[model samples]
Target: MRTLPTPPLCGEPATVRIELYTADSLDACAYTCTGHVIHVTAVVARAGMDAHPVGMAPDVDRPCGYVHVFPTGTLADEPAELSHPRWCDRDECQRRDQHRSRARRVDTNRPEAFIVDVALVQALHPAAEPMVRLTSVQGGAAASLVLSVGQTRVLRYRLANLLDLAGARPNGGRWT
Candidate 1:
Protein backbone atom coordinates (compact mmCIF):
# COMPACT_ATOMS: atom_id res chain seq x y z
CA MET A 1 0.00 0.00 0.00
CA ARG A 2 2.89 2.33 0.72
CA THR A 3 6.09 2.98 -1.27
CA LEU A 4 9.76 2.70 -0.43
CA PRO A 5 12.59 3.84 -2.67
CA THR A 6 14.82 1.25 -4.16
CA PRO A 7 17.44 0.52 -1.49
CA PRO A 8 20.73 2.32 -2.18
CA LEU A 9 23.10 -0.25 -3.53
CA CYS A 10 26.53 1.32 -2.93
CA GLY A 11 29.27 -1.06 -3.98
CA GLU A 12 30.23 -3.64 -6.55
CA PRO A 13 29.06 -7.23 -6.00
CA ALA A 14 32.56 -8.58 -6.53
CA THR A 15 31.85 -11.36 -4.08
CA VAL A 16 28.63 -12.59 -5.60
CA ARG A 17 29.81 -16.11 -4.90
CA ILE A 18 29.07 -15.61 -1.22
CA GLU A 19 26.52 -12.98 -0.24
CA LEU A 20 25.97 -9.47 -1.48
CA TYR A 21 28.18 -7.36 0.81
CA THR A 22 30.26 -4.20 0.66
CA ALA A 23 30.82 -0.84 2.23
CA ASP A 24 29.50 2.75 2.21
CA SER A 25 30.17 4.28 -1.15
CA LEU A 26 28.07 5.69 -3.94
CA ASP A 27 30.22 3.98 -6.55
CA ALA A 28 27.53 1.59 -7.61
CA CYS A 29 24.56 3.47 -6.31
CA ALA A 30 21.39 2.10 -7.90
CA TYR A 31 19.67 4.41 -10.32
CA THR A 32 16.85 4.11 -12.79
CA CYS A 33 18.52 5.30 -15.99
CA THR A 34 14.98 5.45 -17.42
CA GLY A 35 13.84 7.56 -14.45
CA HIS A 36 10.48 5.84 -13.93
CA VAL A 37 10.71 4.41 -10.43
CA ILE A 38 7.44 3.06 -9.11
CA HIS A 39 6.76 1.46 -5.75
CA VAL A 40 7.07 -2.25 -5.18
CA THR A 41 7.51 -3.02 -1.53
CA ALA A 42 7.45 -5.63 1.16
CA VAL A 43 6.94 -3.37 4.16
CA VAL A 44 7.74 -5.71 6.98
CA ALA A 45 9.94 -8.77 6.92
CA ARG A 46 9.99 -10.82 10.07
CA ALA A 47 9.82 -14.57 10.61
CA GLY A 48 13.33 -15.13 11.92
CA MET A 49 15.48 -14.94 15.03
CA ASP A 50 17.32 -11.66 15.13
CA ALA A 51 17.48 -8.55 17.19
CA HIS A 52 16.00 -5.73 15.19
CA PRO A 53 18.30 -2.69 14.85
CA VAL A 54 17.34 0.70 16.32
CA GLY A 55 18.92 4.15 16.36
CA MET A 56 18.03 7.83 15.96
CA ALA A 57 19.28 8.29 12.40
CA PRO A 58 21.20 11.55 11.80
CA ASP A 59 20.56 15.15 10.68
CA VAL A 60 23.52 17.55 10.62
CA ASP A 61 22.71 21.24 10.44
CA ARG A 62 26.13 22.82 10.30
CA PRO A 63 29.87 22.22 10.35
CA CYS A 64 30.06 21.88 14.15
CA GLY A 65 29.11 18.25 13.56
CA TYR A 66 25.86 16.73 14.81
CA VAL A 67 25.77 13.48 16.72
CA HIS A 68 23.11 12.54 19.23
CA VAL A 69 21.99 10.20 21.99
CA PHE A 70 20.68 8.22 19.06
CA PRO A 71 20.59 8.71 15.30
CA THR A 72 18.08 10.81 13.42
CA GLY A 73 17.31 11.10 9.71
CA THR A 74 20.29 11.73 7.48
CA LEU A 75 21.45 15.27 6.92
CA ALA A 76 22.64 14.43 3.44
CA ASP A 77 20.27 16.32 1.20
CA GLU A 78 19.59 15.23 -2.33
CA PRO A 79 21.51 18.29 -3.39
CA ALA A 80 24.29 17.49 -0.96
CA GLU A 81 25.13 14.12 -2.40
CA LEU A 82 28.00 14.32 -4.86
CA SER A 83 29.48 11.51 -6.90
CA HIS A 84 31.68 10.69 -3.93
CA PRO A 85 30.70 9.84 -0.35
CA ARG A 86 32.18 11.48 2.72
CA TRP A 87 33.57 9.59 5.69
CA CYS A 88 30.80 10.89 7.94
CA ASP A 89 27.52 9.36 8.90
CA ARG A 90 25.57 11.79 6.77
CA ASP A 91 27.25 10.71 3.59
CA GLU A 92 28.77 7.32 4.16
CA CYS A 93 26.14 6.01 6.54
CA GLN A 94 22.67 7.57 6.71
CA ARG A 95 22.68 8.43 3.05
CA ARG A 96 23.18 4.83 2.13
CA ASP A 97 20.49 3.78 4.60
CA GLN A 98 17.90 6.01 2.89
CA HIS A 99 17.07 7.71 6.16
CA ARG A 100 15.67 10.93 4.77
CA SER A 101 15.04 9.66 1.27
CA ARG A 102 12.70 6.92 2.44
CA ALA A 103 11.81 8.29 5.88
CA ARG A 104 13.33 5.04 6.97
CA ARG A 105 14.77 4.83 10.43
CA VAL A 106 18.24 6.26 10.16
CA ASP A 107 18.77 3.95 13.00
CA THR A 108 16.33 1.63 11.24
CA ASN A 109 15.12 -0.23 14.35
CA ARG A 110 12.08 -1.43 12.51
CA PRO A 111 10.83 -1.26 8.95
CA GLU A 112 7.25 -0.63 10.10
CA ALA A 113 8.27 2.78 11.42
CA PHE A 114 8.88 3.97 7.87
CA ILE A 115 5.48 3.30 6.30
CA VAL A 116 4.85 7.01 5.84
CA ASP A 117 8.19 7.49 4.07
CA VAL A 118 7.05 5.36 1.17
CA ALA A 119 5.32 8.22 -0.62
CA LEU A 120 7.95 10.91 -0.33
CA VAL A 121 10.94 10.03 -2.51
CA GLN A 122 10.19 10.44 -6.23
CA ALA A 123 12.27 13.61 -6.55
CA LEU A 124 15.44 12.82 -4.65
CA HIS A 125 18.17 12.15 -7.14
CA PRO A 126 20.62 14.02 -9.32
CA ALA A 127 21.15 13.81 -13.11
CA ALA A 128 17.42 13.21 -13.47
CA GLU A 129 18.00 9.66 -12.35
CA PRO A 130 15.35 8.14 -10.11
CA MET A 131 16.87 7.50 -6.69
CA VAL A 132 16.68 3.72 -6.74
CA ARG A 133 19.24 1.49 -5.02
CA LEU A 134 19.32 -1.99 -3.49
CA THR A 135 21.51 -2.39 -0.42
CA SER A 136 21.49 -3.88 3.05
CA VAL A 137 24.02 -2.89 5.73
CA GLN A 138 25.53 -5.48 7.99
CA GLY A 139 28.58 -5.56 10.21
CA GLY A 140 29.18 -1.92 9.44
CA ALA A 141 29.36 -2.42 5.69
CA ALA A 142 27.00 -2.66 2.73
CA ALA A 143 27.18 -4.37 -0.62
CA SER A 144 25.32 -2.65 -3.41
CA LEU A 145 24.65 -3.34 -7.07
CA VAL A 146 23.05 -1.70 -10.05
CA LEU A 147 20.31 -4.15 -10.76
CA SER A 148 17.15 -3.98 -12.84
CA VAL A 149 13.70 -4.38 -11.33
CA GLY A 150 13.60 -7.95 -12.55
CA GLN A 151 16.98 -8.68 -11.02
CA THR A 152 15.97 -7.21 -7.74
CA ARG A 153 12.81 -9.29 -7.81
CA VAL A 154 14.73 -12.45 -8.54
CA LEU A 155 17.24 -11.68 -5.82
CA ARG A 156 14.51 -10.98 -3.32
CA TYR A 157 12.73 -14.18 -4.20
CA ARG A 158 15.88 -16.20 -4.07
CA LEU A 159 16.76 -14.84 -0.65
CA ALA A 160 13.25 -15.65 0.49
CA ASN A 161 13.62 -19.18 -0.76
CA LEU A 162 16.92 -19.51 1.00
CA LEU A 163 15.26 -18.48 4.22
CA ASP A 164 12.52 -20.99 3.61
CA LEU A 165 15.04 -23.73 3.11
CA ALA A 166 16.72 -22.68 6.32
CA GLY A 167 13.39 -23.07 8.11
CA ALA A 168 12.90 -19.42 8.83
CA ARG A 169 9.31 -18.27 9.14
CA PRO A 170 7.81 -15.37 7.29
CA ASN A 171 5.83 -12.24 8.30
CA GLY A 172 7.00 -12.91 11.88
CA GLY A 173 7.66 -16.13 13.65
CA ARG A 174 10.40 -18.23 15.23
CA TRP A 175 12.66 -20.43 13.23
CA THR A 176 11.89 -24.09 13.68
Candidate 2:
Protein backbone atom coordinates (compact mmCIF):
# COMPACT_ATOMS: atom_id res chain seq x y z
CA MET A 1 0.00 0.00 0.00
CA ARG A 2 1.18 3.54 -0.76
CA THR A 3 1.32 6.34 1.79
CA LEU A 4 -0.47 9.57 1.15
CA PRO A 5 -0.11 13.04 2.54
CA THR A 6 -2.36 13.68 5.53
CA PRO A 7 -5.25 15.94 4.67
CA PRO A 8 -5.55 19.34 6.21
CA LEU A 9 -7.77 19.87 9.27
CA CYS A 10 -11.53 19.85 8.71
CA GLY A 11 -12.13 23.58 8.76
CA GLU A 12 -8.67 25.00 8.30
CA PRO A 13 -7.82 24.62 4.66
CA ALA A 14 -4.84 26.64 3.53
CA THR A 15 -4.41 28.64 0.36
CA VAL A 16 -1.33 28.39 -1.81
CA ARG A 17 -0.37 31.29 -4.00
CA ILE A 18 0.67 30.18 -7.45
CA GLU A 19 1.86 32.24 -10.40
CA LEU A 20 1.48 30.91 -13.93
CA TYR A 21 3.66 32.48 -16.62
CA THR A 22 2.76 32.17 -20.27
CA ALA A 23 3.13 34.03 -23.54
CA ASP A 24 -0.55 34.78 -23.94
CA SER A 25 -3.71 34.43 -21.87
CA LEU A 26 -3.66 34.17 -18.07
CA ASP A 27 -7.05 32.57 -17.68
CA ALA A 28 -7.26 30.96 -14.23
CA CYS A 29 -10.58 29.24 -14.84
CA ALA A 30 -9.14 27.00 -17.54
CA TYR A 31 -7.63 24.57 -15.02
CA THR A 32 -9.80 21.60 -14.27
CA CYS A 33 -9.71 18.25 -12.48
CA THR A 34 -9.74 16.33 -15.76
CA GLY A 35 -6.15 17.21 -16.62
CA HIS A 36 -4.80 16.19 -13.22
CA VAL A 37 -3.01 13.08 -14.43
CA ILE A 38 -1.29 14.70 -17.37
CA HIS A 39 -0.27 17.68 -15.30
CA VAL A 40 0.97 15.43 -12.49
CA THR A 41 3.01 13.39 -14.95
CA ALA A 42 4.56 16.53 -16.35
CA VAL A 43 5.35 17.73 -12.84
CA VAL A 44 6.94 14.43 -11.88
CA ALA A 45 9.07 14.36 -15.01
CA ARG A 46 10.18 17.95 -14.65
CA ALA A 47 10.78 17.72 -10.91
CA GLY A 48 13.11 14.78 -11.48
CA MET A 49 14.12 12.49 -8.56
CA ASP A 50 13.08 14.45 -5.50
CA ALA A 51 9.32 14.66 -5.95
CA HIS A 52 6.76 11.90 -5.45
CA PRO A 53 3.04 11.50 -6.17
CA VAL A 54 0.37 11.58 -3.47
CA GLY A 55 -3.31 12.18 -2.60
CA MET A 56 -6.47 11.11 -4.43
CA ALA A 57 -9.22 12.70 -6.45
CA PRO A 58 -12.69 12.01 -5.05
CA ASP A 59 -14.31 11.73 -8.44
CA VAL A 60 -11.60 9.74 -10.24
CA ASP A 61 -10.73 6.22 -9.14
CA ARG A 62 -7.08 6.66 -10.11
CA PRO A 63 -4.53 8.13 -7.75
CA CYS A 64 -4.68 11.92 -7.47
CA GLY A 65 -2.82 14.68 -5.63
CA TYR A 66 -3.24 18.26 -4.60
CA VAL A 67 -1.60 19.74 -7.68
CA HIS A 68 -4.30 21.20 -9.90
CA VAL A 69 -3.27 22.77 -13.20
CA PHE A 70 -4.68 25.57 -15.34
CA PRO A 71 -3.54 26.26 -18.87
CA THR A 72 -1.26 29.22 -19.46
CA GLY A 73 -1.24 30.22 -23.11
CA THR A 74 1.88 29.61 -25.22
CA LEU A 75 3.16 31.59 -28.19
CA ALA A 76 3.58 28.40 -30.23
CA ASP A 77 -0.19 27.94 -30.12
CA GLU A 78 -0.86 31.54 -31.14
CA PRO A 79 -2.04 32.44 -34.65
CA ALA A 80 0.71 33.52 -37.05
CA GLU A 81 -1.21 36.54 -38.31
CA LEU A 82 -1.01 38.16 -34.88
CA SER A 83 2.72 38.42 -35.31
CA HIS A 84 2.47 40.02 -38.73
CA PRO A 85 4.30 43.34 -39.27
CA ARG A 86 1.00 45.22 -39.37
CA TRP A 87 0.41 45.33 -35.60
CA CYS A 88 3.89 45.23 -34.06
CA ASP A 89 7.51 46.16 -34.80
CA ARG A 90 9.20 43.75 -37.23
CA ASP A 91 12.45 43.61 -35.26
CA GLU A 92 10.67 42.95 -31.97
CA CYS A 93 8.62 40.24 -33.61
CA GLN A 94 11.78 38.50 -34.78
CA ARG A 95 13.28 38.63 -31.29
CA ARG A 96 10.08 37.31 -29.70
CA ASP A 97 9.86 34.49 -32.20
CA GLN A 98 13.48 33.55 -31.61
CA HIS A 99 12.92 33.35 -27.87
CA ARG A 100 9.73 31.36 -28.39
CA SER A 101 11.61 28.92 -30.58
CA ARG A 102 14.26 28.38 -27.95
CA ALA A 103 11.56 27.72 -25.37
CA ARG A 104 9.80 25.41 -27.79
CA ARG A 105 12.98 23.41 -28.22
CA VAL A 106 12.70 22.67 -24.51
CA ASP A 107 8.94 22.10 -24.21
CA THR A 108 7.23 22.20 -27.59
CA ASN A 109 3.58 21.32 -27.04
CA ARG A 110 2.86 22.13 -23.41
CA PRO A 111 1.51 25.28 -21.84
CA GLU A 112 4.16 27.71 -20.64
CA ALA A 113 2.92 27.68 -17.05
CA PHE A 114 1.62 24.91 -14.75
CA ILE A 115 -0.76 26.29 -12.15
CA VAL A 116 -0.62 24.28 -8.90
CA ASP A 117 -1.84 24.47 -5.34
CA VAL A 118 1.30 25.20 -3.34
CA ALA A 119 -0.52 24.93 0.00
CA LEU A 120 -1.54 21.36 -0.69
CA VAL A 121 1.98 20.62 -1.87
CA GLN A 122 3.27 21.94 1.42
CA ALA A 123 0.77 19.84 3.31
CA LEU A 124 1.97 16.76 1.47
CA HIS A 125 5.72 17.26 1.75
CA PRO A 126 5.74 19.09 5.06
CA ALA A 127 9.41 19.79 5.70
CA ALA A 128 10.70 19.16 2.21
CA GLU A 129 10.89 21.94 -0.32
CA PRO A 130 8.59 21.04 -3.21
CA MET A 131 9.72 21.08 -6.82
CA VAL A 132 7.82 20.33 -10.02
CA ARG A 133 8.64 19.28 -13.57
CA LEU A 134 6.91 21.16 -16.39
CA THR A 135 7.24 19.47 -19.76
CA SER A 136 5.54 18.87 -23.06
CA VAL A 137 3.60 15.63 -23.46
CA GLN A 138 5.84 14.63 -26.39
CA GLY A 139 9.04 15.21 -24.35
CA GLY A 140 10.26 17.98 -26.60
CA ALA A 141 10.77 20.71 -23.97
CA ALA A 142 10.81 21.07 -20.17
CA ALA A 143 11.32 23.37 -17.22
CA SER A 144 11.46 22.99 -13.43
CA LEU A 145 10.04 24.88 -10.49
CA VAL A 146 13.56 24.92 -9.19
CA LEU A 147 16.42 25.18 -11.66
CA SER A 148 19.56 25.50 -9.50
CA VAL A 149 21.08 25.43 -6.05
CA GLY A 150 21.22 29.20 -6.19
CA GLN A 151 17.50 29.33 -6.84
CA THR A 152 16.92 26.97 -3.94
CA ARG A 153 18.89 29.26 -1.68
CA VAL A 154 16.88 32.27 -2.77
CA LEU A 155 13.59 30.47 -2.33
CA ARG A 156 14.54 29.16 1.08
CA TYR A 157 15.67 32.58 2.23
CA ARG A 158 12.49 34.20 1.07
CA LEU A 159 10.31 31.53 2.69
CA ALA A 160 12.25 31.90 5.90
CA ASN A 161 11.66 35.64 5.92
CA LEU A 162 8.00 35.14 5.31
CA LEU A 163 7.80 32.68 8.15
CA ASP A 164 9.52 35.08 10.49
CA LEU A 165 6.57 37.44 10.52
CA ALA A 166 4.15 37.23 13.45
CA GLY A 167 1.03 36.29 11.50
CA ALA A 168 2.96 33.77 9.44
CA ARG A 169 4.14 31.82 12.44
CA PRO A 170 2.34 28.59 13.15
CA ASN A 171 0.06 28.01 16.18
CA GLY A 172 -0.25 31.62 17.24
CA GLY A 173 3.24 32.38 18.43
CA ARG A 174 3.93 35.72 20.13
CA TRP A 175 4.99 38.65 18.01
CA THR A 176 8.71 39.47 18.21
Candidate 3:
Protein backbone atom coordinates (compact mmCIF):
# COMPACT_ATOMS: atom_id res chain seq x y z
CA MET A 1 0.00 0.00 0.00
CA ARG A 2 3.06 2.20 0.05
CA THR A 3 3.48 4.82 -2.66
CA LEU A 4 6.48 4.35 -4.96
CA PRO A 5 7.93 6.29 -7.89
CA THR A 6 8.22 5.08 -11.45
CA PRO A 7 11.63 3.83 -12.50
CA PRO A 8 13.11 4.88 -15.82
CA LEU A 9 14.68 2.36 -18.15
CA CYS A 10 18.40 2.18 -17.35
CA GLY A 11 19.39 -1.08 -19.11
CA GLU A 12 18.00 -4.40 -20.19
CA PRO A 13 18.47 -7.51 -22.29
CA ALA A 14 17.04 -8.27 -25.75
CA THR A 15 13.63 -9.17 -24.28
CA VAL A 16 13.45 -6.81 -21.33
CA ARG A 17 14.77 -3.46 -20.09
CA ILE A 18 15.11 -2.46 -16.44
CA GLU A 19 14.46 0.95 -14.95
CA LEU A 20 15.43 1.72 -11.40
CA TYR A 21 13.70 4.34 -9.26
CA THR A 22 13.51 5.33 -5.62
CA ALA A 23 10.42 5.88 -3.45
CA ASP A 24 10.77 6.88 0.18
CA SER A 25 14.50 6.11 -0.25
CA LEU A 26 13.78 2.48 -1.21
CA ASP A 27 14.91 1.22 -4.60
CA ALA A 28 12.44 -0.32 -7.04
CA CYS A 29 13.10 -2.00 -10.37
CA ALA A 30 10.69 -1.72 -13.29
CA TYR A 31 10.53 -3.40 -16.70
CA THR A 32 8.49 -3.23 -19.86
CA CYS A 33 5.84 -5.88 -20.44
CA THR A 34 3.75 -6.04 -23.61
CA GLY A 35 4.05 -2.35 -24.33
CA HIS A 36 3.22 -1.38 -20.76
CA VAL A 37 5.66 -0.27 -18.07
CA ILE A 38 5.26 -2.53 -15.04
CA HIS A 39 6.92 -1.80 -11.72
CA VAL A 40 8.45 -4.60 -9.69
CA THR A 41 9.97 -4.51 -6.24
CA ALA A 42 11.83 -7.81 -6.21
CA VAL A 43 12.93 -10.45 -8.70
CA VAL A 44 12.84 -13.83 -6.95
CA ALA A 45 15.22 -16.42 -8.34
CA ARG A 46 13.52 -19.86 -8.45
CA ALA A 47 16.28 -22.02 -9.86
CA GLY A 48 19.48 -23.08 -8.14
CA MET A 49 22.91 -22.05 -9.37
CA ASP A 50 24.84 -24.48 -11.52
CA ALA A 51 28.58 -25.08 -11.63
CA HIS A 52 29.98 -24.80 -15.13
CA PRO A 53 33.44 -25.38 -16.52
CA VAL A 54 35.38 -22.28 -17.41
CA GLY A 55 36.15 -23.63 -20.87
CA MET A 56 32.84 -25.26 -21.82
CA ALA A 57 29.34 -24.62 -20.43
CA PRO A 58 26.03 -26.38 -20.99
CA ASP A 59 22.70 -24.98 -22.12
CA VAL A 60 20.55 -23.13 -19.58
CA ASP A 61 17.26 -24.54 -18.26
CA ARG A 62 13.73 -23.38 -19.04
CA PRO A 63 11.55 -21.38 -16.62
CA CYS A 64 14.96 -20.97 -15.09
CA GLY A 65 13.76 -17.57 -13.97
CA TYR A 66 10.25 -16.32 -13.32
CA VAL A 67 9.30 -12.66 -13.05
CA HIS A 68 7.34 -12.42 -9.80
CA VAL A 69 5.47 -9.22 -10.41
CA PHE A 70 4.50 -7.40 -7.24
CA PRO A 71 1.45 -5.19 -7.36
CA THR A 72 2.10 -2.15 -9.53
CA GLY A 73 0.30 1.02 -10.48
CA THR A 74 -0.32 -0.32 -13.98
CA LEU A 75 -1.79 -3.49 -12.52
CA ALA A 76 -3.61 -1.59 -9.79
CA ASP A 77 -6.62 -0.45 -11.83
CA GLU A 78 -8.41 -3.71 -11.39
CA PRO A 79 -10.02 -4.61 -8.07
CA ALA A 80 -7.99 -6.93 -5.90
CA GLU A 81 -9.73 -10.27 -5.60
CA LEU A 82 -7.60 -11.36 -2.68
CA SER A 83 -8.38 -9.75 0.65
CA HIS A 84 -7.34 -10.08 4.29
CA PRO A 85 -8.48 -8.71 7.59
CA ARG A 86 -7.25 -5.14 7.91
CA TRP A 87 -7.19 -2.90 10.97
CA CYS A 88 -9.96 -0.35 10.57
CA ASP A 89 -8.34 2.88 11.87
CA ARG A 90 -4.68 2.00 12.10
CA ASP A 91 -1.95 3.55 9.97
CA GLU A 92 -1.70 0.28 8.04
CA CYS A 93 -5.35 0.57 7.07
CA GLN A 94 -4.89 4.12 5.89
CA ARG A 95 -1.89 3.07 3.81
CA ARG A 96 -3.84 0.19 2.27
CA ASP A 97 -6.67 2.53 1.33
CA GLN A 98 -4.26 4.91 -0.30
CA HIS A 99 -2.75 2.10 -2.38
CA ARG A 100 -6.18 0.91 -3.44
CA SER A 101 -7.13 4.37 -4.55
CA ARG A 102 -3.91 4.77 -6.51
CA ALA A 103 -4.32 1.42 -8.20
CA ARG A 104 -7.90 2.21 -9.13
CA ARG A 105 -6.68 5.30 -10.95
CA VAL A 106 -4.41 3.39 -13.32
CA ASP A 107 -5.68 1.46 -16.32
CA THR A 108 -4.22 -2.02 -16.03
CA ASN A 109 -6.06 -4.06 -18.68
CA ARG A 110 -4.57 -7.43 -17.86
CA PRO A 111 -5.56 -9.74 -15.02
CA GLU A 112 -3.72 -9.66 -11.71
CA ALA A 113 -1.97 -12.99 -12.35
CA PHE A 114 -0.20 -12.15 -15.60
CA ILE A 115 3.40 -13.21 -16.04
CA VAL A 116 6.41 -11.04 -16.85
CA ASP A 117 9.86 -11.91 -18.13
CA VAL A 118 12.85 -11.34 -15.85
CA ALA A 119 16.60 -11.84 -16.04
CA LEU A 120 18.72 -13.33 -13.30
CA VAL A 121 22.34 -12.79 -12.27
CA GLN A 122 24.60 -13.79 -9.40
CA ALA A 123 24.88 -10.98 -6.88
CA LEU A 124 27.61 -12.53 -4.76
CA HIS A 125 30.92 -14.04 -5.84
CA PRO A 126 34.63 -13.71 -5.56
CA ALA A 127 36.01 -10.82 -7.56
CA ALA A 128 39.59 -11.91 -8.19
CA GLU A 129 40.58 -15.44 -9.04
CA PRO A 130 42.74 -17.28 -6.51
CA MET A 131 46.37 -17.65 -7.50
CA VAL A 132 47.76 -21.14 -7.71
CA ARG A 133 51.47 -21.18 -6.96
CA LEU A 134 53.74 -24.18 -6.69
CA THR A 135 56.85 -24.09 -4.48
CA SER A 136 58.03 -27.67 -5.18
CA VAL A 137 59.11 -29.15 -8.57
CA GLN A 138 55.81 -31.13 -8.91
CA GLY A 139 53.30 -29.65 -11.36
CA GLY A 140 49.58 -29.51 -10.54
CA ALA A 141 46.41 -28.35 -12.28
CA ALA A 142 44.10 -25.64 -10.90
CA ALA A 143 40.67 -24.61 -12.12
CA SER A 144 37.92 -22.21 -11.05
CA LEU A 145 34.15 -22.79 -11.17
CA VAL A 146 31.99 -20.32 -12.99
CA LEU A 147 28.26 -19.78 -12.40
CA SER A 148 25.72 -20.71 -15.04
CA VAL A 149 22.71 -18.72 -16.22
CA GLY A 150 19.09 -19.79 -15.48
CA GLN A 151 20.01 -20.68 -11.92
CA THR A 152 17.30 -18.91 -9.93
CA ARG A 153 17.13 -21.19 -6.92
CA VAL A 154 20.76 -20.49 -6.19
CA LEU A 155 20.04 -16.79 -6.30
CA ARG A 156 17.07 -17.22 -3.96
CA TYR A 157 19.25 -19.13 -1.52
CA ARG A 158 21.82 -16.39 -1.68
CA LEU A 159 19.14 -13.78 -0.99
CA ALA A 160 17.95 -15.68 2.04
CA ASN A 161 21.52 -15.96 3.23
CA LEU A 162 21.97 -12.23 2.86
CA LEU A 163 18.77 -11.50 4.79
CA ASP A 164 19.97 -13.75 7.57
CA LEU A 165 23.41 -12.15 7.51
CA ALA A 166 21.80 -8.72 7.89
CA GLY A 167 19.32 -9.88 10.57
CA ALA A 168 16.31 -8.76 8.57
CA ARG A 169 12.82 -9.67 9.73
CA PRO A 170 9.86 -10.40 7.54
CA ASN A 171 6.98 -7.97 7.45
CA GLY A 172 3.59 -8.68 9.17
CA GLY A 173 5.41 -10.49 11.97
CA ARG A 174 5.65 -13.69 9.96
CA TRP A 175 8.87 -15.71 10.31
CA THR A 176 9.95 -18.99 8.78
**lDDT for each residue of candidate 3 in 9-72, tens digit (9 for 90 to 100):** 4333213333332232212233333223322223211111111111112342212112222444
User: What TM-score do all the candidates reach, one by one?
Assistant: 0.25, 0.18, 0.18
Instruction: Pick out the ten consecutive residues of candidate 1 with the lowest summed lDDT.
Output: 35-44
Task: Predict model 3's lDDT versus the native.
Answer: 0.31
At residue 78, what lDDT does model 3 achieve? 34
- Against the true structure, candidate 1 has what lDDT? 0.30
Q: Write the per-residue lDDT of candidate 1 for residues 28-121, one digit (tens) a residue.
A: 1122111111111111122111112122124412111111211122212334444432221233333343322333323334543222222112
Kindly report the root-mean-square deviation of model 2 from the true structure over all alpha carbons. Answer: 23.8
Minimum summed lDDT over a 10-residue window in model 2 is located at 117-126
* Whole-model Cα lDDT of every candidate shown, in order: 0.30, 0.32, 0.31
Stretches off by above 4 angstroms in model 2 are: 1-72, 83-88, 94-176
Q: Which pairs of residues clash in candidate 2, taking residues 3 or more apart in a chain or in different chains?
A: 46-133, 47-133, 106-141, 106-142, 107-141
Sort by lDDT, best first: what order?
Answer: 2, 3, 1
Cα TM-score of candidate 3: 0.18
Judged by lDDT, which candidate is best?
Answer: 2
